[model samples]
Structures are given as C-alpha cells and as structure tokens.
Target: PRIIVRAIRTAGKLAVDKVKELSVKIDNKSPEEQRDLLQKCAVTAMSSKLIHQQKGHFSKMVVDAVLSLDAPLLPLDMIGIKKVSGGALEDSFLVAGVAFKKTFSYAGFEMQPKSYDDCKIALLNIELELKAERDNAEVRVDNVKEYQKVVDAEWQILYEKLATLHASGANVVLSKLPIGDVATQYFADRDMFCAGRVPEEDLRRTQRA
Candidate 1:
C-alpha cells in the first residue's frame, strides 16, 4: 500500500479579536494610523494562541506519512536523500514521487478545490503526478520524525536567511523557470520560506513548536 501524508485546514480564532472594524472608520483614519493599527493587530494575533495553529493542526496528520517515503527532497537543502529526512534524490522521479505529494497536501488540496475555475492546475497535477510515481515505483514510505527534527533545524536556518532578505525589502519574483506554471509556486513559497518569507507570526509559531 502507498502511504501519503495529508493536512487539513482548521478554522482560526483570534482570542481578543471579535472587534468589528467598519470600513468607514478605517477610511477616516490616516494611512500612517491605519498601518500602525494593522501592525498592532497582526502582532496581537501572533502573540495570541492563534499563531502557527494550522501547522500544529496539519503536522499531526503528515509527519508519519513523510517518514514512509523511500526518497524525499528537502527545500532547504536543495538535494534529495535516500530517506525522507536525510540523504538525496538520485533522479527526478524520486523528487516527484515524494516531495510533490507532501507539498500538495500541505496546500490543503482536495476534490472540492478541484472544482473551482481559478484553482491552480499545476498544484493538482503535482498530486496526481506523485501518486503516479508511487504506483510506478517499488519505494515505500516510512516514519521520519527523528530525521525530521534535523531537517527542520536546517530549514530554520534557511528560513531566517530568507526572512532577513525579505525584511531588507528584496523582491521575490521567480528568477527562472523552464515552464510557465504556478505548478512551482509552492516550491517557490517553500524555498523562500525555508530561506523565511512566511508571515513572521507563522515562523515564530513554527519556532516555538
């Protein structure tokens, strides 16, 4: 049997944040004041229990699935390993087989999202393609918790680098591509995030976990 990790999206709650801000009231506020308010609100949301909530919700389901793969590419390391959290991918098939599925599930994909007119096709194809890899190959997925901590440790270093770059105001457009597809958008997001473009609160939440 093929094993795959799946993540579910959870509703978020802002503990102190049921306050309704009317657009009119926001409109009356100066731009500087508005920026300040938003900053504070963002900080409050991060500081409150809501930070990294989705991660905790999702990781619980995905960690073991990640371990079962025969091979996996880590975004931070830019290489494939013989196992899910260590080593390197020797071929495109290996990367496609393991990394692709995890990325797809992480985005909270499903048949429901597939019906949307604007839903990204590349992302869906990623899921389909990885499933194909699993069926075509003899590889087996296993548990990766121990190696995952090391991978995560490296990922954090990369994330801090990217976050600092983004904070310096560097533009984050795709630098080069062989195909025109949002197909790789998540990879880009993961790379930047591994490098550190995820919203700060999200990063902090991951750090705490």
Candidate 2:
C-alpha cells in the first residue's frame, strides 16, 4: 500500500511540473532562447523519423518554419510539404513562399530572369499557341500569296494576344495550357519569367500568397 501511494504522489508531481511548463508563454523568452528551445523540441519530435540522422538541418528547417508563421496557434494547414523524387534527404528545405517543381520548361527558361521582387504575376488558362480558325474549317488558297496571308493572320492573332498580356504590367506569366516556344521566347526577350502547365493547386496557393 505504501509503494502504490508513493507512485501516485510521483505521478501527481510529474503532472504538476508539466502543467507549469505548459503554462509558460514562449513569447516571453528571448529570440535566441526561443530558437534554441524550438530546435531541441524539433529534434526530440523527429528522433524516430528517417531524417533523424540529419537532425541539425531538419531542426533548423523546423525552427524556420515555426518562426516564419509566427502565429499564436499554428496554422498547420497553411504549410505544405511536397516530397519530390530524387535528391538526398539532406536536400529537403522549407520555402517561406510557394514553389513549383514541374511547371518550368527548358524552352527559353535559361534566357529569362529567375528571381523577381514585387513583380506582377499573371495566371492564364488560355493557350498561347496559334489556334485553328474553327472546328472542321478548311481554307482553299488559290495561290502562294493567299496561303501566306492566312498564315500571317494566324500569327498576327497570336502576337496580338501576347502583346495584350505584356501590356497588363505582368512580369511573371503562368498558364494552365502550353505557353509554347514562341510565347516563351517573347517573355524571355523582355527579361520576364514565364511558365506553362502549372498545376491548379499551385495557382491557388500562389494567389493566396
């Protein structure tokens, strides 16, 4: 009976101690102290995870993630983790803003500027490529000049559409459909950034950000 009584007292003491710890407001601590505490907590939380071996890196990422959000109650739903294939576990990182892996293309990708500051972004669902005149529409050109005019008209329509987009003061362009080589080169020539085939989820998240 004495042993059971002693165990009950110890359990009560532990509970009281935990309550006191929990009651302490983290904001009351200094920035450096808070960071240290969070790092230790992150390490402990991931002790059983596969990333435990790289705790130092993962710990910093966790601390950054928490500090960046800076919320009284964590809005965990706002944070997203995308597990991309390839690269080591050490390659994992936390982006303060949204990022996409698959949307960028090789065409004119290297020519355009990579980073932007306070730049306007335009999200489009329409294709930038030249479209057919109409469904089941056929044009019987009598001569070479006639065929050239038909081609020029289609090209002019594409060019005008691109010009209209450029006039919108958008330096960054994202589209759900293919932007194609012609449109890609157009943006690159102006030192702007453009990407096509962007996922719908990415578009929504970008808008929110």
Candidate 3:
C-alpha cells in the first residue's frame, strides 16, 4: 500500500536525521523578570478556581514559595499545604519555611520545651513504643516473677534506645513511627521536643530545611 511505502521512506529518512534537544532553557531571564512571569502564570492557572478574585494574594505566595527553595532542582513534594480552620481564602498565605501541626500521642507534651535555637534535630524511622517485639511473640511465663522479668527486659531495651538517642544531643526528635507514653515521659523529663507519626513528606522537607 502507499501508506506502507510512505512509512518506510519516512523511517529511512528518520534513521539518517540528527536528533535535536527540545527542552526550553530559561536561565537567561533576570530574577525579577522570572518572578513576575511566575506570578502571572500562577494567577492564570488559578483563574478557574473559586479564589480567582484573590489571585493577587495567592500568586504572590506562589512566587515566594518557589523562590524560597535553595536547591538546584525544584520539586513539588518539598512544598506542604496545611489547612487551618476559620481562615478566609485571602488570608491563606504561604509559610516561608516548613510548618506542621502538633500531634501529641501521649500526655505531658506541654512540659517539653516550646522552642529551640540552634538545637540539633533527629529524624528516626524506628518505634519507641514500650511493647513486645514487633514479631508479636507471646511471652510464656508461669509466675508473676517471670512476667516481671519480661516487662523489665522490654523497659531495658527501650531505655538503651532512648539513651542512644539522648546521647546524640538532638533536642527535637521526629519519628515516622509511634513514640508512646514511656518515651514521651522520658523526653519531657529531659526537656526535649518529641513528635511522632510525622508524615514522610514533612520529614523529607525538614531534612532539606
């Protein structure tokens, strides 16, 4: 068929043709010009949204958020969005840096330090809950004395892990796993900030920040 002949000729020509890069490079633009362009693009993108009337506010926030990144590659995952109740769309402004809500799994969270300056932060993926091994192995104990030993062993393991964490001098401890009552009390006793069950995205951003 004529179609097959045309395809063959086109393929032969393509095989002899040189490839060209098609990605746009916008590095020539000045910073101010780039910011203006981003603001305009942001406003245009939001034109169909409910808060289009507040495009000016949101567009400025978009530009500020993009400009705040200190990396060579801009990733959308690095940005976080938290919704606080009782705030108008116009009041929705961008936070300059990473911000997440407080989630306390245990009591005495108030006893911990409210804030820290120049303090080391540690990100953990391990669990600090005082429970049996994650394997769910049942302890076979016939008497109260043996049960006491089992509980003590669990406490000792938790204490060793906490001790290692404390030795790192990280006042702010954030973990993806659960940090239960005993760990929370230990942190409060030491006047350390501890937050558990943090989202992986927030942890990544915190690491970068």
Candidate 4:
C-alpha cells in the first residue's frame, strides 16, 4: 500500500512539472505570442484552488501596480510589503515609499515629527560615543578642576557634533551604531527623531530616499 501511494505521488509531481515546462515554452515565440501564453498561464494559475475566486481582482491589481511604476525597469527592492493581521487579502496594497524596521532610541521623542514631509534626514555611520587616546599610558589627574575640565571637553565634543547635525536642518537622524544616552537626550530635547543601531542597508536606502 505504501509503494502504491509513493508511485501515485511521484506521478502527480511529474505531471505538474511537465505542465509547468510546457507553459513556459515561449522563448522562440514573438512578443505578442509570448504575452498571450503568459496571460493564459496566469488565468490557469489564478483559477486553481489556492487563489480562491479573487483571480480577476488580483490579476488586475497586479497589472495596475506594475503600470504605476515610474520607470520601465522596475527594481522590486524599491517595493515594500507590510502585512497586517486584521485585514483581508484584498485590503493588502502597495505603498510608494520604503519602510525601515527601525524604532526611535528614545520613546519620549516618538510623538515628535509624526511625518517626514519636508524633513531633512542625516545618516551617521558612526557611534555617538566619545573616544579617547592614551598612547598606552595612564595620565593621573591630581586636581578636581583638571578632571572636571577633561570631562567638560569630552561632553563639548559630543554636543558640538549633535549641534552640527541640528544646524543642518536634520529633523531625522539615523545612525548605524549605538547612540549614547547623552546624545539621545540631546536629540530628544530638540524634538528630533533619532534612531540608532539601524542596519547598514537601511541607512543607505534612507539616505537614497
């Protein structure tokens, strides 16, 4: 009985494979013929049990979406798919912009800049923390005044960097590395949308957009 079931499954798989092979044999055909073959295949596939009865609606939606692209050559990476749990399949639609999976480092600043309209964005590929060079030597600060000066200077540098970004009209800041608490607070006080530790690719796409 197991052998009979295995043979039946194998035959069914082979039949599906053969149908797929024959359906795509439009390489040598003219452009019109190729298009017709593709349309027929689309119809057949959409009519299958998997797609339910929304074949015509889905087919038209797909064609309209492709036609809506700005250029003839469509790079699919420019498209974003956001799936919501409560909506029907027909409720799914295409959005015109790229969406990154990043959140603001500070929850308090989320209410600010609800939109990016006319907002300038700054992309920083570096950490917002302070770095020191000791030359493999330890310097001892004997006086409290001198120790305070060093601390003040380090903070000044970080403040200046943040100020520069703010001066550039950057309402949004995306960093590829962790943003120190001081920097995050500075941005939050300014009501800026700052997100840190974002992926490199996301930063690049945000910059391009």
TM-score to native of every candidate shown: 0.19, 0.66, 0.82, 0.57
Each candidate: RMSD: 23.8, 8.8, 5.2, 8.2
Q: What's the lDDT for all of these models?
A: 0.33, 0.85, 0.86, 0.71
Residue 76 in model 3: shift from native, Å?
Answer: 2.1
> What would the per-residue lDDT of candidate 1 be over residues 23-140, giving only the tens digit for each residue?
2367788866765565555445545453344433323223333333333432222222333554422211223221221222233122112122322111111011111234554533
Instruction: Judge candidate 2 at residue 9 and give its lDDT.
Output: 100
lDDT of 2: 0.85
Better of 1 and 3 by lDDT: 3
Residue pairs with clashing backbones, model 4 = none
- Pull out the clashing pairs in model 2: none
lDDT of 3 by residue, 171-209 (tens): 999999999988988999998989999988889999988
lDDT agreement of model 3 with the native: 0.86
Give me the candidate number with maximum TM-score: 3
In candidate 3, where is summed lDDT lowest over 10 consecutive residues? 17-26
Ranking by TM-score: 3, 2, 4, 1
What is the full ranking by lDDT, best candidate first? 3, 2, 4, 1
Query: After best superposition, candidate 1 residue 178: deviation in angstroms?
Result: 19
lDDT value for model 4: 0.71
